[model samples]
Target: MGNVILRYINLMVVTLLILSFFSFSLAYLFPGHPIENLTGIRLENISQIENTEFNYSSGESLLVQYWHYMGSLFDGNWGVSFNSGLPLYDEITNVLPASIELSAYALFISIFVGIPLGFLAAMKHHKLTDYSLLSISVLGYSIPVFWLALLVILIFSLQLGWFPLSGRISLYYEIPDITGFIMLDIFLSDIDNKEAAINNVIRHSILPTFSIALVTTTLIIRITRRSVIETMNTEFIHAAYARGLSGRQVLVQHGIRNALMPIFPLLAMQFTTLLTNAMIVETIFSWPGIGNWLIQAIYHQDYPAIRAGMLAVSALVVIFTMSIDLTIRLMDPKRRRLKRAAI
Candidate 1:
């Protein structure tokens, strides 16, 4: 176990280095300096930019520049944004919570809603419920995220007025930045309007959450349906049924647990996918998250911001990937040992 942990840690370190290298390369790989591109004036003098540090200069070689960049990562001197003049690391930190909060909610919805629908579809194989769920999953997966965002905004926000159109929380309640997560902050703070704050936060979150959740839920449905259907045909599932377990009991006790073994990787991949889709969803809804921040950085051609955002996002992807693998392995010790033996 210790050896396995060390191996994964080493792998994660190498992955982070590689990702950071590509992310940091944006400074040279991009056509022009962000300031130059934004101002339509060539930066003959790097000193003109106020209160900022450049990672490298034209005088330095690529390897030397990367060395400085890596040093800055450990030294906590990631430089400031050309567009905002804020520390790039701090800026990434601020936006990450919103992205995490949104992704968390979306994932919750995907699993809670999708898994059951999938199981029902499998259980009802040739029935109307099965066909209906399949169609819904198809439509959900097929639609573009931006279009889904707009459509939901139109219906729920504009037409029905059930949820807010954009943002993480209502302006009516100013939750403090205790934990960076708005809803969680609201709960922690003695704001005096905890119920209202909670309610408003949830209401504001519904539309954007739904927009992203629908796509992931559809994927979960298909995957779950396939996994469960196959498990249903297996000898273990048949034995459970023959042991006089009720239909629901057999599916719930024997089927769902076994079916989930194949779904761990999908969960990890879907989490990353949710982050990618968030770039689109955040823009359409004007949500103040990393995706929206990254879009703004792009428009201004803020290389520092771009580099920081990409590295931050990439690190998150790698972390979640590793974490999920650890979690699934812990859930099934035999499978973990088998993999270790094979390796």
Candidate 2:
């Protein structure tokens, strides 16, 4: 187990170095000087921008600049935003929580809703329930996230008034930032209307969460149904059924568990997909998250912000993928057997 973990850690280190090289190369690989490109200013005198620490000059070679960049990473300096003059790392800290909160809710909805629906669809096979779930999944998959968000906003927020149209919380409640997560912040803050704070957060979160969740849930349903169906037809499942296992027991202990093994890798990929989709969802809903922040940075051509955001997002995906791979390897007996045989 320790050896496996060590190997994965080594792999992650190599992957991060490669990612850093490519991401840091943005400074030189891009057409103009980083500062000129970022700020849209043409300075004839190098001395004008030379004194400033943020500006990239023609004097420094890419290797030296990359060495400095890598050193800064170790020193916890993730560069500064050209547009805002704020530390890129600090900006990431501010918006990351919202993304995490939104993603968590979306994943929750996908798992709790999708898995059971898929299970039922697989169990019913050729029945009405199977056909209905397939149709719904197709519809959900086909709907663009932004459109779905707007549609829900029109119905739930504009017409029904059940949820807020946008934002993370209502201005009516003054919630302080404790953990950066609004729900946790509500609990920690000394707000007069705690109930109002919680309610407001929930109301504001529903539309965007549901919008992203619907798309992700559709994917989960299809994957789960396919996996379950495959497991159902296996000879091991039939053997288990013949061993006096009831339908529920066979499904729960054997079928779903076996089906779920394949789903782990899919879930990891879905997590990154959710992050990308989250940027769009965040933009539509005007949610204060990394996605929205990155979009603005791009529009303004903030090189530091762009580099930092890409690096952070890439690191997240890589770390998550590694964790999921390790977990699956540990849990799956077949992998363990293969590992032992190879050793």
Evaluate all candidate structures by whole-model CA lDDT and list the values in order. 0.82, 0.84
Q: What is the lDDT of residue 6 in candidate 2?
A: 78
Model 2 over residues 245-290: C-alpha lDDT tens digits? Answer: 9989998888878998888778877888788888899988999999
lDDT of 1: 0.82
lDDT (10s digit) by residue, model 1, range 61-128: 77876787788788777768888787887888889899988999999999999988988899999899
Q: Quote each prediction's TM-score.
A: 0.90, 0.92
- Tell me each candidate's RMSD, in Å, in order: 3.1, 2.6
Candidate 2's displacement at residue 11, Å, is: 2.0
* Most lDDT-accurate candidate: 2
Return the TM-score for candidate 1, rounded to 2 decimals. 0.90
Worst lDDT 10-window in candidate 1: 50-59
Any runs in candidate 1 off by more than 4 Å, and if so which? 33-58, 242-246, 338-343
